[model samples]
Target: MSLKSIAAKLFAGVIYKKTQKWATNPVETQQRVFEGLIRKAATTSFGNDHNFGSIKNHSDFVSRVPIRDYEALKPYVDQVIKGDENILWPGKPLYFAKTSGTTSGAKYIPLTKESMPYHIEAARDAILHYIHETGNADFADGKMIFLQGSPELEEKNGIKLGRLSGIVAHFVPAYLQRNRLPSLKTNCIEDWETKVDAIVEETIDQDMTVISGIPSWVQMYFEKLKARSGKTVGNLFPNFNLFIYGGVNYEPYRAMFEKLIGRKVDSIELFPASEGFFAYQDSQKDKGMLLLLNSGIFYEFVKADEFFSENPKRYTIGEVELGVNYALIISTNAGLWAYNIGDTVQFTSLKPYRVIVSGRIKHFISAFGEHVIGKEVEQALRDAMEDSDAVVTEFTVAPQINPSADLPYHEWLIEFEQEPNDLAAFSNAIDASMRKQNVYYDDLITGKVLRKLVVTPVPKGGFERYMKAVGKLGGQNKLPRLSNDRTIADQL
Candidate 1:
């Protein structure tokens, strides 16, 4: 056997054994992971102050540390930014994963020597587990293109700061680096258009097997490739089989990808955020991702409806009920204590503890009591596009709470690459889809309290212009699919 094939087989075997153990008894696995995290962080100042050493079980830990979001943990993160040792983690973090901040211009999430493995190894095993399940070993034999942020990391207070994908690039296995593209020089180019141009030039003739990145940016790459080569993706890269994606719901983009490639390829979805690697799609037949219970992170869930309440009841892994929407709470080796990452999820399976990402807490609309979320809106749009033979390049939804006209409505700003022949029919299809998905919206329409959703076809490049103005044009920065207010709508 080839060296790569041999390595793939052995790696997959080991990961399968580990996953089998956790699948058999996730409760036991989670308890062990929780205790290990506590023991590891107990010596740190944040942990010591919270009395982590005295915490013997889940209840004790929960009673001591209150749930917090980015704003609440900013003080400690500030200390870490100033090179304070043992502030959150055991020591000064090696780097900080900079993300779009709500209050500030950016959020610097700590990445330590201890916590880095969770990001790197989990990503590796995500691919390994897929190979094990499908008996696909030939993927490693060809090149893999990872569309990511600038590989050039910025320095602050003697620590590195950059996108998480760029930081993870430094840890790519030496052997695998040989099969990865584009060159470090090309990746470091900050401008998205320039970077995509460079990538197309560098990889046009390569024998590619895997492509990984956020869906939007990757779509840009695929489009550029098609424009340059005058061929479908399946024809250009005959060996290409795996497309690994995350950072946004892929449902809206799925149809576009299938149309672009001319044939469907294998896909794996992951839940890797700036905070940590949480879960990955382990089985193609399974609808939800298998929660990474043993990845040096302790999981907690708070009912999404109660997340903003004064005292939201927190549930451990064993306590979470299937099919209920919950905002995730996490404590990790990175020393983030009981932090809420803002994304909401619903447990689909309790036996192996799998979950479907429902939406973001801030990316929901209840302006008129419809309580519509990102997932529903994306699905509705996808169904509408499918029925009308239209394709959306980018889109966002915002509630127009006060209209100069008689009724308020939800407005969708869509940039379509292929516009539908019958625009009104397409709009009506979307309205019907939304009514089917949301009972509250249907009721409001029936009662004449709210008008049907308004679809505005923005000229090409409109969404891109908006993202560029916000300085988040590419690399893990996606347009929030839904908004509760008109801030985004006004800007668009």
Candidate 2:
């Protein structure tokens, strides 16, 4: 280890001890945090923003404004980027987190300094809580490898700046970020280029004690790691104690990766987007993680039974019900009130407030999670089709999860300008694409639920019909993947 890393670890040891002492008294720690949250609210402009200042009456707020969807808060995000100090916590506006939406180009979400801490705290607490629960306490003892997006931050005057992901590395406990991946080629940003080869080369020998990243990305890395390095990730990071994932469903890839690792690597699901880290898996091997940054977020939930046009009943942390798949709504410390993040979730139970990610209310694919959405599915199709030597001229996948005797699937109706000669290989390539893009789909294939993603070839002019009918295709948005299924992406 470098001298800087060793010294930082020594200092972290002190901080970790203090944190341990504080964590033992959960009630006291939270009460102080609660007080801090209150002070944070009371001193500022919650009342002006109609944000939760002192949710003295949770029921009162519940009755006043029902739960909201992402559209409900786009105006607030607008206010945030405008540098509304009272709302966005008074600072220079950082880069907006670009997220996909049905109605617009990537949503450039404003990330404020005040609210960004919540994401970091959630990530830290998830690891810490995992250690405490697992009886392996002192989470900082081992190396943690995060397959995070590389910095897209712009640099000027020898200083780099960017979004939440960039900020995450910029603020990483100092000991962690500088540790190179042992290979010259390391992590590449999630973009058009493939950095899998480089990362696989670097990581095969390292003792990566903890691994964190999106399930799909991790799965892809695992595949590349095994192929390029002649070692499974399990053999590579044999000392790894945890595999924390965010961004997508991990259950499908669970058995695959776990088997490769030789033992069940502890997994934690983190609910984080470009906007924030909303929740995390609390207990190791358990289904859910306790919400870490509750103090930073003014919590609210939209009852699934409630209609969007109707007011959404908001909830405080105390009022949140467990086990029901209610949509998560939040107003954070930095600024955002009654915001709908578009991601949907339901609680597995209450008391400790364990929850599950139901799915994106906006993003969906219904035929048993074969429901693909937006560019993700399209890219998969492109990769698969091209790889299979089947050139796709136009295609559209619609939710066909409805009851059908033949088969229920997120049906992909394709219109090829020229029918590829190798039809069977093309079909197999599409299957491979789906499997790779969604590990859950791969699990289903291996588990033998459905044969493959049902692809029905349409005429060459199929997507043109959609574009002509809708007047546009994929600039801001496209057709819905899940509408009537109500499973969101969770059914997969």
Candidate 3:
């Protein structure tokens, strides 16, 4: 690490210690930090004084602002990308983070210099704490690994410059590149699929220092591991370091991952988005961590309440009692006031602000009264595969709609890396896991309402239908995981 980079890390650590202490004092103490950002944003050129909502100074604002989905913010992002000088804060717009939504086309979210610090700082703090908690002087002692993200930046002219991924690739120390995701042979120029394949091949022989990426993509590579080695973690990549991943719940992937590697996958739950760097893992073994970006936004928590409450406004982080489930809403340093990305979570601790992801509001199923959530369903799938040493290469779950029957149910279509005997046992284990891991599904099973779940295997690359449908047939592209409808189920 450069003296400058080391100093950057230390500064972030100092900020974290202060924030961690503040988290312990009660949510009220955070009012100053959270309110400070809102006020700072207001005074900036982006605030549009005539349009500042529900807030004058930080104190003048409501405890929480109404949460809005990305569709609601499309106009603002569109304006900024179109060079609406007045829409942006008083700074050179760094670049826009590209994001996609189910209903909306690509969203280009403008990120300003002021908000960029929060993203950079959160990333720096997470690494420092991971090193501290794991006592892994690896970065300090030697090489480190990072599952590199996209390698290029999108430009309006034929080519502009590095996008976020290309920038990260550039920032990495030269020494680390020799070691970065050792399996990936290509340099930055390789496209996503080629890079992913090289990464998969490399893991077989090398000692992975650190690993990162979305859980779904990570699992896809695990199949390659199975094909080349025909061995578990002990047989290949035994000297592997910790795995830092997010973008989706890791709980569902636990069983297959553990079985394939036969090792503990130390995780750093990351809440990174193209829009912003939201949160990171504070401890090596912890499931969740303190969100240090409070300086970047006003945080809101929407508790699970009666559907369509007479008072439409939901709970705030201030009013949240510990152990309550809430979806996060944020007003960013970029001048996005009150945005909700549809993620649901539960507070595990008040101090240090620990949380466990519940599921997405749009990503669940209530048919058959299963109320099966994306995270829970994922967990059940993993647990079911625990005892069976099946080599599953790809899989997708969808809610089964039985028009003639009274209720819907869950179904999984999987493509295996290696076939397994005892199909009955495998299917049974999956059933038991679903009923045991998910209470909602268990209730339905007990009531004899939902159909007995079933697992069917497809040929290799069978799940590619959705990928082709979306024109992202290879590489970083994947089918929408854990869908609520039969569009996915019927495809099988």
Predicted structure with the largest TM-score when compared to the true one: 1
Q: For every model shown, what is its TM-score relative to the native structure?
A: 0.96, 0.64, 0.81
Error of 1 at 121 (Å): 1.0
- Which lDDT tens digits does candidate 3 get at residues 1-492? 555346545655675576667567645655665666655555444454434445655434433334457787666656666665546454436666665556787766666767666666566567667755554544433334555455556674222333454444545655345655543235353555566667666566766556666666666666567777787754576655566676667765665677777888566787766556766778655666566535566676666433235434555555667755566776666666667767777776655677766677666676655666666666666776667677665677776676466565677787776666887688778888777866878888778677667787888777655566656643334455567777776766
Residue 462, model 3: Cα distance from true site in angstroms = 2.8
The segments of candidate 2 whose C-alpha lies over 4 angstroms from its true place after superposition are 1-72, 79-84, 91-95, 135-143, 154-163, 178-193, 363-398, 401-492
Over 333-415, each residue of candidate 2 has an lDDT whose tens digit, in order, gives 54454567766666664545566776555555545654443434644665664454354444445555553565444555665
Per lDDT, the best of the predicted structures is 1
How does residue 50 of candidate 1 score in lDDT? 91
Model 1 quality (TM-score): 0.96
Name the lDDT of candidate 2: 0.56
Say which prediction, candidate 2 or candidate 3, comes out ahead on lDDT: 3
Order of quality (lDDT): 1, 3, 2
Q: Candidate 1 regions off by >4 Å? A: none
Better of 1 and 2 by lDDT: 1
lDDT of 2 at 99: 51
| TM-score of candidate 2 on Cα atoms, chains taken together | 0.64
lDDT of 1 by residue, 71-95 (tens): 9999999999988899888878989
TM-score of 3: 0.81
Which is the better candidate, 1 or 3, if ranked by lDDT? 1
